[model samples]
Target chain A: MKSNLELLTIETIAEGFRNEDFKPSEVMEAFLENIKVKSELNAYIDTYEDDAVSKAAEFDKLFKEGREDLPILSGIPISLKDIFLVKDKICTCGSKMLSNYVSNYDSTVKKRLDDQGVIILGKTNMDEFAMGSSTETSYFGPTLNPWDHERVPGGSSGGSAASVAGRLAVASIGTDTGGSIRQPASFCGIVGLKPTYGRVSRYGMVAFSSSLDQAGPLTHNVRDSAILLDTLSGFDNRDTTSLKLAPTKCYEALKKNDFSPSEFKIGIPYDLLREGLDSEIDQSFNLLVAQLEKMGFKIIDVSLPSSKYAVAIYYIIAPSEASSNLSRYDGIRYGFNEESTPETLEEFYVKNRSAGFGEEVKRRIMLGTYALSSGYYDAYYLKAIKVKRMMQKDFNEAFKKVDCILTPTSPELPFKLGEKKDNPLSMYLSDILTIPANLAELPSISIPFSISSSNLPIGLQLTSNKLCEDTLLKVSSILEREVGFKSKT
Target chain B: MVEKKEVLKISKLSRLLIEENKIDSFLKNFSEIIEYINLLDQADTTEIGKDEEIVEYSFRDDSEIEKLEVEDVVKNSAKVENNFFAVTKVIDEE
Candidate 1:
């Protein structure tokens, strides 16, 4: 029963507290203990042990007193990708530069979660500054995939994904900049949502690519993603990109259960399936299509012509923005400072950044700076933006004929840690299928579909039009129930 | 292929110091990535003008508030002096 309680969903945990079956403190203890047991996975950068226990205790008191003012996610233990700022807490952003940096203010997402009374288990790990496709670039070390201990939990939201898959927490928050959340979620065999780009605020999220970065949830299943989204998303004056639109009513839409596969037009982009797709993944995907056909959804062949160039586009734009965003990390204001005095300020800047950042982070920063450099700006940054426009056009055109598009979350299964560490480009390819969704600024979710012959999990990606996360969630929940792919971790 | 001199220039421009020994490996990786991104040259974007707005952002009111205390602002600084961040001196007196 204790084990069962550890894996309970947000809804179940809330109901359990309401019924007086268990208190929020028990849930916190269970997760905290599980987190300790899974420490070797390197899934968390730090855990909020005292803060979480105290929060849970306070919530339990409210529950015991029969307070009607309790928030929806009150007492649920959730992990945060170290990228989100929690006031007075260390937000390393999985990089050594800001290893000791503490945030003075809460990110909109963190503040929202706090308001809802969600117990933060800790800050999960990720790629350094959300640059890489794998968590290997993290200064804290790579987060190992819980499913296969030898393989990586996909990143840059890898630790968040692993935490949910390992049942360390009910659900966790992760940011997706070119598929950081979804790709890792796919690798770890869990539900990861990358909400519409502006649907969630990015006020205190350390900027990777300002245009592409979005914060969303990673969970064991779909409903929790919706519940987290319902609470985490809203307008924030702090983030200019934050949507001024009304609440998406994501949780309420899930309860409606008013979905028909027959009525919704699902598009299959044959372009994604043709090249570099693993045979086993292709077979599993075909089987899924057959199941959807039997369920009455019309699968139309749609083409995202410019999607083939998505990785190239993402690499250019993300790095260019990163080069600019990370320029603020010079040694003076905050972060790692070099002890040796330099004759010039420029020397201090160069030396501090060189010593502070990891290899991959430096590579991208250089790449971005080069792309945004005078001579190459037209060839790289400008060209990538044009391609981005075309990619967005491709998705918009596809959506005209179909309600949503279906694709594999990753082209291949989760690979062994250090497999692609030496070859950075090969590592970047893992996010090929997931990158287009971010490039288009669309809502996408990765739901576990099957376990591979080697016992690794593979996920199916569903992307809907911008702000159509409700449609994406409804279809994903239906498929989640139908597939019922039990997570073995 | 990028030359070592070019790599040095780019690294200096980026304000990131690449170690002298690692320049060769950095050049190889940088060139390969550049070659990969050159595929964008094949895309015909003549119809899409630079004036075409890709994203529209909503602005917020410019109300200023005392959000962070001076202590919190300088909390993470390597050196703080009188509520101000202490940095290496940039100007030298004649």
Candidate 2:
């Protein structure tokens, strides 16, 4: 047996299980042991030990009985970010307000995964309310980067990315409101996908910004991401925003075993390279482009000028909607309520809310409220919306000339925890490259490309037009094979 | 320019009470954020439309639907009395 199961890809795990070389229960036990040993990473909020064990036992029984109804992920263990509701489990969303709140129903994604026979490993930690770029805002404390314990695992989905990188679980589900999934995935040296908004059902997901919030898989490679997306994507009557189109059978596309790099037209955004990106990242990105060119893919220089305003516009629009969506957690319904003797009903409302929310959450709510307020609405929120429309148009035009757009996921690798805590603006800049995908409602993936001189992993981002995740995965699979940076669990 | 006083006002509206000690730091940080956002005001938006069109949709009539009894609504509350949600009195007589 390997010293750590970190190097186990989904393909390898599935092959092993199919050949009867190892049982699902044994794999689950190995992950549990690794999680315990690497407890300092703080990757999980809750582990479903009995649930995982029972599921694994059921899969083992089915295997012995020669039943074949189970899907490809019949015995795979997966972690869920704290935001996605798992019935009867604590879905805290990394906030003290919902710390004791047990979900009464499984989220649509969770239900679909369960139907596929994927065992629920646990719930990973996250930033409170998915508000921060780094998981440092988590009420339970931040999840550490698996590569370098001192640096952050890129965040809101920090714990999910860290757990997968650290090999605590095979793959995890993460919610990306802005760059929550990709940014952390970049920092942790794993693959993360933010499926186009409406690509996955948001039925039981706690809303941050309904427009920007999307759920996708964080896996070890593009194939696993495609498989997870196959299980997770579909139309649900519960989420009105879910696309009415038939659910994409992404896994079938990957299973076809096609490896023609000449078929891919990789779009390179020249503007991103000339901007505020780190020099090392720029060099690594050029090296990646050189490798792809050698593989016969045409590297076309495309321009998305409006992308320069993504972070500024995202902050405004996301917060504006977040302020409205979060208004439901007024302490009386589903969150923490303060025991205060107020002189008026209004005072009761004030005191409870004042006590419940954390500093970062409060800061965002204030900024959002002011942006949407009567006098300032047109100046801030509405203006941001217009810019968002333009940004989407820019992407729509860019996709016409290329198969996929590629860029560095983060300008630089993960910094040490607490390094950017005091400077909120600088922290917001970390998601500069990723926010455009969300704004455009496009599918994007981040895969680890190289390690920095400091041994921190760097991520390369590949994005495709809406509903074209197949193309994105195909390109990513080719890159993964060429780059060959497998997890060293 | 956003001032400390303005920050306090927004805090009150948002129901976030920043302590007196931390108000200055919060104000400074907020000012910097606002300054960064203000750069967008310089963009040429002369062709942009100001008025947004609101779309209205028709829904099935609910006039014939029976309303839920007050008892049903208050049944899940931890404490309820006389078809009302019970709680500590929030207002005091002057």
Question: Which lDDT value does model 1 have at A71?
Answer: 79
What DockQ does candidate 2 score?
A: 0.30
**Which predicted model would earn the best DockQ?**
1
**Candidate topping TM-score:** 1
TM-score of 1: 0.98
> Each model's C-alpha lDDT?
0.89, 0.84
lDDT tens digits, residues A1-489, model 1? 455678788888888899899999888888888889889999999999999999889998999999988877988999999999998899999999999999988888988888888888999999999988779999998899998889999999999999999999899999999889999989999999999989999988899999899999999889989988888787877888988876568788888988777878899999867989988999999999989989888999999989999989988999999999999999888988977788898998998999999999999998898898888999889889988998889999999999889998999999998998778888887889999999888999999999899998999999999999888988888889987597775
Q: Model 2, A295: alpha-carbon shift in Å?
A: 1.3
Q: Which ten residues in a row have the lowest lDDT in candidate 2 chain A?
A: A1-10
Spell out the clash pairs found in candidate 1.
none
TM-scores of all predicted structures: 0.98, 0.94
